[model samples]
Target: MSRSIEYGNLMHDAMRGLIRKVLQDVADHGLPGAHHFFITFDTGHPDAELADWLSDRYPDEMTVVVQHWYDNLEVTDDGFSITLNFGDAPEPLYIPYDAIKTFVDPSVEFGLRFETQDSDAEDDEAEDPAAPAHLPAVKPKGKKLKPDETKSTSDKEDEAGVKDAEIVSLDSFRK
Candidate 1:
C-alpha cells in the first residue's frame, strides 16, 4: 500500500496562528525586555491599509519598527491595530496576518517569513474547499556567515594593535 502526500493549507493557517500569537504576546506584555520587532508587509494586500499618503509613499513594501512610542494596540480575530508615531504624527494602522511578509527579532536572532499567496484563492479555499490552490512555499534556510565575512571581537582588537603600532612608529619619527 502507498500513502498519498498530505499537502494542505494547515501550514499556512499555523503560520498565521503563530504570527497572531507573537503579536498577542507583545500587545499583552509590552514587548518584554529588549525585544523589538521589524515587520515587513505588502501594502497592496487586501487586509492591509495605510493612510492615503502612506499608501502612495510606500506602494509596494513597508517595514515598521515596533519598539518605543506606540499606542492604542488592539488585537482581533481578523487582525491587529496599533498607533505608530510617523514623523511626529500619530497614525493608526490595521494589518492582517496575510499581509505580513516577514517578522524579525534581532535580539534573539529569530525571524519568520510568510509566503505570499493569492488573496482571492486563499479565501475561496478557506471556505470549505478541498485543497488549497497553492502549497505554502518552502522557506529558504539561512546559513551562518563565513569566518572571513564575520569578524570577531578579537579581530577588532588585532586591528587596534596594528593601529597602535603605526601610531608608535609615527611618534618615533616625531622624536
Candidate 2:
C-alpha cells in the first residue's frame, strides 16, 4: 500500500489559518488603511448561523462585506461572529471558518476560494482512506472583480515592479 500526501486538504487548512490570522489582526487593530473584505460562505453549513431572512435570501451561499460599519467582531478557534447593519436593522451572525467558501479583499484584488466536496464522495473517502480525492470544478460567484477599478496606492506601487494582484485557486495545486 502506497501512502500519498493530501496536499489539497493541507493547503485548504493553511489558507483557512491565514484567514483566521488576518481576521484576528483586524479585530485587534481595526482594518488598516483601505483594507476590507468580502467573505462568502455556505449558509447551509451546519455550523453557520445567520438571520432566517438572510439564509432565505442567499439560500446556499452568501457574501458579506466587512468594512465601514460593523460590530461585535469576535474570533475564536472555530469561527467568528459579527453584527452587520442591514437597512438600519443590525443582524448578528456566526460564521464557522469551515463554512467559508470564499474570502476576498477587493481593495487588493486578492481572493481565496474553497471547493466543496460532495457528501457521498467524502463518505467514500472516509471508508477507504487510500482513495484519491477528486477536485471539483468550482465556479466562483458574486461581484466580478475589476483590478483596474480597484487599484489603490499599493497597486500603483506595482509600477515600481511590484507583482500584480491575483486570485489563487487551490485546484491549480492539484496533481
Candidate 3:
C-alpha cells in the first residue's frame, strides 16, 4: 500500500464531471420535477466569483436554492453562470468547478461534501478535518461552487491572495 496513489483526487474529478453534466442538462432543459439543488461553497475561497453584497452577506460559507426563480443559466467548460433573486432583485453569479464545496439534491437525499484546505496544502489535497465542512463562492453570475466535485481551486485564489475549497473524506470515522 503506497498510501499515496491519490485515489481520492481521481474520485473528485469524476464527481466534478457528474456535476457539470447535471448543470448543463438543467441549463438546456430545466429542473425536472422536485429536483432542486442545495449548493454550498466557500464565500471566502479565492476562486469564487459573486457579488460584493453577497460576499458581505455570507463571509465564510453560503448555500443557495436553485429551484424556480433563476435565469440565464449557462454552463460552460470551466464554470457556469446564472442570475438568482435576492430580496426581490435578480443578481448575476459566476462559479468555477474548483470553487465548489458541496452539492445536494435533498429531493433524493443525494449530496456530496468536498475537501477544503488552507493555502499550504500540496497538490490540491484533501481538506482539513478541523475546518468547517462547507461554504459559499464569489463575484456574481455563473456556475458557483459546492462540495469537492477533487476539482481544483487555484487561479482565482491566486488572484485574491487567499485560500479556499472543499472535499470530504470519511477516513476520520474509521480509526
Candidate 4:
C-alpha cells in the first residue's frame, strides 16, 4: 500500500487535552505551593478574548503569568477564562486553545512549546468585540494628496526598498 495516514493532527489534539486536564485540575483545586502557569498566545488571533488595548500593545504575541492572584479560572474544551490584574483593576481574559503557543510551569520546570499556526484573522475580524481595536487615526479612503503634500525627499524611498527596485511595465509583458 502506498497511501499513508497523517497522525500529526491526532497527536496535536491529544496534547491539547493534556493542557485542558491540567487547567481543569487547577480550577478544581487551588494552585499548589510555588505552582503557577506561564501561558503565551497570539494576541492578534481573532478568537483571543482580551482587551483591545492589550492586543494592540502586544500585537503579535503575549505571555500572561497566572500565579497567586488569578481568579475564576475556568477551562472548557475550546478555551479557558480567568480574571487577572491589569493596571489597578481586574480584567478577564479568554484564550482559545489554538491561540496558545507556549505553556510552562517554571516551578516544576515543565514546558511545552507549540508551533505557531497561520493566522486566520481578516482585517475586520481583528477588531475585538468587547473593546474596539486601538488604531492610529487615519484619513478617509480615496483622498488624494496634493503635489505639495507628497514626499519630495528619498528618505521614504530607501526605507520602502523602492530605491533599488527596477520599474516594471505590464505593457511590455502583454506584447
Q: Which predicted model would earn the best lDDT?
A: 2
Worst 10 residues of 3 by lDDT: 166-175
Ranking by TM-score: 2, 3, 4, 1
- Candidate lDDT values, in order: 0.59, 0.68, 0.64, 0.61
Each prediction's total of clashing residue pairs, residues at least 3 apart in sequence or on different chains, is: 0, 0, 47, 0
What lDDT tens digits, residue by residue, belong to model 4 across residues 9-70? 45567667888999999999988898887677878778888876566545676667787689
Per-residue lDDT of 1-175 in model 2, one digit per residue for the tens?
Answer: 9998886678778888989999999989999999888787888999999988667646677667788899999999899999986655678999999998777776665677777556466654442222233322333323234433221111111343532222333344444
Off by over 4 Å in 2: 118-175
Where is the poorest 10-residue window by lDDT in model 4?
A: 148-157
* Per-residue lDDT of candidate 3, residues 76-169 (tens digit): 8777788877655677888777677777776665767677434475654455432333432232322454543323222133244443332223
Which regions of candidate 3 are displaced past 4 Å? 1-4, 117-175
- Tell me the lDDT of candidate 2: 0.68
Give the higher-TM-score candidate: 1 or 3.
3
Return model 2's CA RMSD, one decimal.
11.8
Candidate ranking (lDDT, best to worst): 2, 3, 4, 1
Candidate 2 least-lDDT 10 residues: 148-157
Candidate 1 colliding pairs: none
TM-score of every prediction relative to native: 0.62, 0.67, 0.65, 0.63
Question: Global CA lDDT of candidate 1, please?
Answer: 0.59
